[model samples]
Target: EPEVTQTPSHQVTQMGQEVILRCVPISNHLYFYWYRQILGQKVEFLVSFYNNEISEKSEIFDDQFSVERPDGSNFTLKIRSTKLEDSAMYFCASSGAGNYGYTFGSGTRLTVV
Candidate 1:
């Protein structure tokens, strides 16, 4: 089975710093997404991309967050400025056409201090 893969399994950054989380979703998937879990909280959707454009985004994905499909296989999420509250496990996910079930990456643990 194909899977979504994330880099820098863990990251540490200071407040106000910039960080880019990288991911490689399944090649055949038609939809991509980003989600984050703040420690014990439920997973929250940040944004979704389809056909190379942002199809939807949540309020949590404000000006500080950006997503890109810079190449055929890579997806990225950039945080313009890190905040203590932004620390969490960011997950990258992808789903096939007409399918809601997503294959999620293990996640990149962001630690802001």
Candidate 2:
């Protein structure tokens, strides 16, 4: 029953500030992903990391955004400059296999004011 864990469950930052969200997924999982849910919008995939590199990223992942696995167990997403629209609940997820379901972290709610 391994699960993904995220720190700083909540964060508040001023506009134009940089923000980093950290996460540690199930050690045994092979795929790691970052998703965001705007106040009342559907979950959107931001990026996916595999084999220590970005396997895929959505249009939202522009030059302002980046993802990294500094260590084998920790995955992080960094937003170079925050904006009001960037505020959302960010979730980290991991899956052992494509066919298997994902285990998501409780999520880190980012608030930009």
Q: Against the hidden reference, what TM-scores do the models get?
A: 0.98, 0.97
Whole-model lDDT per candidate = 0.96, 0.94
lDDT of 1 by residue, 16-106 (tens): 9999999999999989999999999999999999999999999999999999999999999999999999999999999998847899999
Per-residue error for 3 in candidate 2, Å, reads 1.5
Task: Look at candidate 1 and give me any clashing residue pairs.
Answer: none
Best by lDDT: 1
**Candidate 1 displacement at residue 53 in angstroms:** 0.9
**lDDT per residue, candidate 2, 1-113, as tens digits?**
67799988999999999999999999989899999999889999999988999999999999999998998899999999999999999999998876988999999999999
Listed per candidate, the RMSD to the true structure in angstroms reads 0.7, 0.8
Q: Which stretches of candidate 2 lie over 4 Å from their true place?
A: none
